[model samples]
Target: MIADFDVSSDWHVAAPYGFLRGLRHEQPVFHSPHLGAYVLTRHEDVRAAYGDAKRFSSAGSLTISRSLTQATRDRLGEHGSFLSSFVANVDPPDHTRLRRSVSRAFTPRAVAAMEERFRRLNEDVLDRVEPDGRADFVPGLGHIPSTKLTARFIGVPESDEEFVKSHVKDWFMLFLSPQPADRQLELADSFLEYLAYVDRLVAARAAAPQDDFTSLMTSLIGSELTHREVVELISTILLGGNDTVPNQLGNSVYRLLRENIWPVPADLTQNAVEECMRIDGASLGSFRYAITDIDLHGVTIPAGALCLLSTDSAAHDETVFDDPETFRIDRPNADAHMTLGYGIHFCVGAALARLQLRTALDVLGERLPGLRLAPGQPIAYRKSIVGRGLPALLVEWD
Candidate 1:
């Protein structure tokens, strides 16, 4: 069974549940040549690996796909090794310290305070499309609000929005995918440019602080972090919210309408969002490196082995979720899905993401209860192993 499963095939990358379901039952810890990692499909195994930081280190989790060529390294110059201080790619001690420095921005009070503004943003975007009675929800409804709010939160100037938008995907591709040396070099140039822009923003904030995320980090530069660390930290936060929210919004809205669960009651909007996350989440899974030999179900993952913890597969495990294939907005255990993450490295922006999802649902449900997918439009998804998302969702309402 393991011999037949090709993790990189277009079929599997576009929709992998069928193959993953078989892997969960036959070989839960099968190693994949494409990913060069032992894939864990069971919910229990993935969750345990996530919580055990000592056994499964997070270092190099994102960039382990391939090594950089010396030419690419030279192109990067000082920016060649930027992930050293990224919160998601480091273990505790450094991870704890770095996470603590930005923890205040995500506190409940702070996140709650953004709801009023978040709602207005969603309403404004939806209002523009309501008169059309049809629109590509991905960009028209999803991307606009998410990008605007994230940029403002991170202190990106309106004048630089196009620059940031055009290049952030390069950062995503460079770190998240395995590419050829030449492609890597191209991405390296884009990344270095982005780093320089961030460095400029940091220096400006240091000289004249503002009420934004960059200013917050600049204040702690000498006290809690170094200049380079602050630059990498802000870059991580900027990229963190960049596509994840739009991807999730696209996923959630697609599920709600396709499954006829729209107009989710005001009280159950959160439950509906969790159900969408469980059934069709944007985050497929993430990588973790093994620190020591560990045996699971008669398979041994050797020391320093890379592991792909399949949260998407775990969310569909029959043992954990009854009638796993069914999309039920009222499923009692929908919140148990590991889409956001688990344990210490759980998503720091979970609250803000939820706020955006809930607000979108409320605004759409109130205004477009008749919403439905536009007929004759083939459903398509971006071919990404880590983040599952629809690039465009053509929607219509009476």
Candidate 2:
């Protein structure tokens, strides 16, 4: 029966729900032809997989499509492992060290210091939209704030602003879908270009040493990281900041508009963002590899088997949440959503993402009080399990 199942279509349509129901009712640990991995769908099972990093390793090629070429893996491994130091791809000791190196810059104090700057930037974007009373919120407002904030964090000059934003989106897209070979090479080229740009910035920081993250990272240049490692580290920072925040902002607006809400309260916007991410996360699930044959909730998952934790389903589990299908801003446990992930590999930028989302909504509410979706137009959904969001969010205000 499982052999005939169309895993791709099933995953594409109902997403984690399709897989979750199957796992809970029929097979808790079953192989998926599309992902070529064993999917763990139940909330308890996903939580177990997340908590036990020893039993479930993250240091492996963890893509849904098992179609990656050996050359691609070798290329990634050689360039100081573009996928490695990002914290999402590594295990304990190294992950801990790499994360700590940049953690100082993202502290609450540092984040709070930028509030005035963010407010100004947000208002500037809002001003452009106010005159027109309608705009594509993603590119116009949503993408700009996150991209600019990340640039500030890395101390990349505002001159290179457009350059960074242009390439970053393509980098995310490559991870989402199987693009053509030329497009793949173009994506890799864009990444290389960004890395080279950071290299120059790092060198400048070493000479002049400004009071910014670039200087902080540059201080460790000779001791902790080589030139390439520094580039990869900054690239990871840019990628993380660039990829998710815009989607969260866009998804938040889309949800609010869909539900026919107006003057979205600051608290409601926050709740709506959490619920939307829980329901349609930028990432469908995260990947792990079983380190040892282990029995979880009566299901035996063999060693070296690829594992998928259905986070979307975990957030919507009927056992954990009441009326899981409803979008309730007032839900008591709404903040406990799993979109940022859980346990060892939880999103390091969770706080930053939240701040950006909050700032966007706060500014939008203040400037565009009557914001609403354009009547009868459909919001386009982006295709990618790693990141799910609207491609565009069209809105109008009087």
Candidate 3:
């Protein structure tokens, strides 16, 4: 069955565990013809690969699918070269400075400061949902808070928040999804427009200082980072922060409810969120290019080969967690999951995201302890090699 594994197939995105388990068991590191890249599924291999960023470079690695066609490439190229400048894709010295500059604005102190705001935002959103006894879980539960908090996180003004919410950069991930060519062909032009809009925001922030993240970044620009770097960093935060966390809200609640484990004990629920993320976490990991022909676990990855590190599968590796496949609310060591990523490239907004998830779920459970999946409603997950997300989730509370 491992021989037949196909990354491009619909089944792989929706349900890959059966074959991913086979890869970790039979071949920890093997190149699959279907994926057109070398894959590492075992926990040890995935963690090591992430830690060895010196050997495994992150350039030109925005997605794990590696499916950009000549047409998509040309369309994307017209925008600008800033995509490669993303903090996640840059190597060592450059990565160090970029991350430092971004962190300057997103300090742990700053993240902690947002907790009260998030708690209120959580209350505000849920306050509306409570009266209905039913609500759209994905947006009502996750997207709204993610979008609002990120707007606050990035320092965008109230007038522009709607635009920020509208262009969540889901299109960027859609490029990797299994959509029709025409629909796929449609993303780049709009992306270029969104890029222009962000460019304007960067300019405005630079001109008139504000208390938000963008103005803070302006202070660091030139002295610590390039103007282009600011654009990339903000773009990454705006889009990435918006896309992943919202979907995770739906996925986490969905999993917990399906297992009949909602209203998780307050003591261990945060760990339950950690466990939720480990199992098929945001996007199925990402790509790293081998700097030179190298060997790992007896498998030789050629020079210039793209290695898709299966962080999702790694979570399930029997060696890491006692039972990765199960939803365990009381797991002692659940934070070990690599859902938000690892090493220097770990998500800058992780603390803020965690506060959002914990606050949202805790609020929902306390307010609507009997939330249930709506009858006759089918669950939906957006099809993508990266970005494991749901568009909507319907739930009712008696």
* RMSD to true structure for each model, in Å: 1.7, 2.8, 2.1
Candidate 3 off by > 4 Å? 3-10, 63-82, 174-181
The lDDT-based order of candidates, best leading, equals 1, 3, 2
lDDT of 3 by residue, 317-364 (tens): 878888667767777777887888888788887887787788778887
Q: Write the per-residue lDDT of candidate 1 for residues 1-398, one digit (tens) a residue.
A: 44544545667656677888999999999898777899999999999999999999998787676467888878877776678668888999988988898886788988888888878888888778889999998878888777878888889998997788767878778766667889998898898888889989998998999999899989998898788888887787777667888898888888888788878889899998898888888898889999999999999999999999999999999999999989988899999999999988899999898888998889889989999989888877777678788889999998
Candidate number with the higher TM-score (1 or 2): 1
Rank by TM-score, descending? 1, 3, 2
**Deviation in angstroms for 83 in model 1?**
1.8
Put down candidate 2 lDDT per residue, 1-398, tens digits, no spaces.
Answer: 34422434434533445446656667867777666677776777888788888888888544334333455444444542355555577787776776677676778888877777777888877777689988888787788877887888788788888898877666555554577665666676676676667778888998999888888878987776566556767777787777778877787777767776656776677776677677656666788888999886677878888888877667777777788777777777776667788887777778778777777778887888888887777655665555667667778889
Q: Quick one: best TM-score, which candidate?
A: 1
Lowest summed lDDT across 10 adjacent residues in model 3 is found at 170-179
TM-score of 3: 0.93
TM-score of 1: 0.95
What stretches of model 1 exceed 4 Å from their correct place? 3-8, 66-70, 180-183
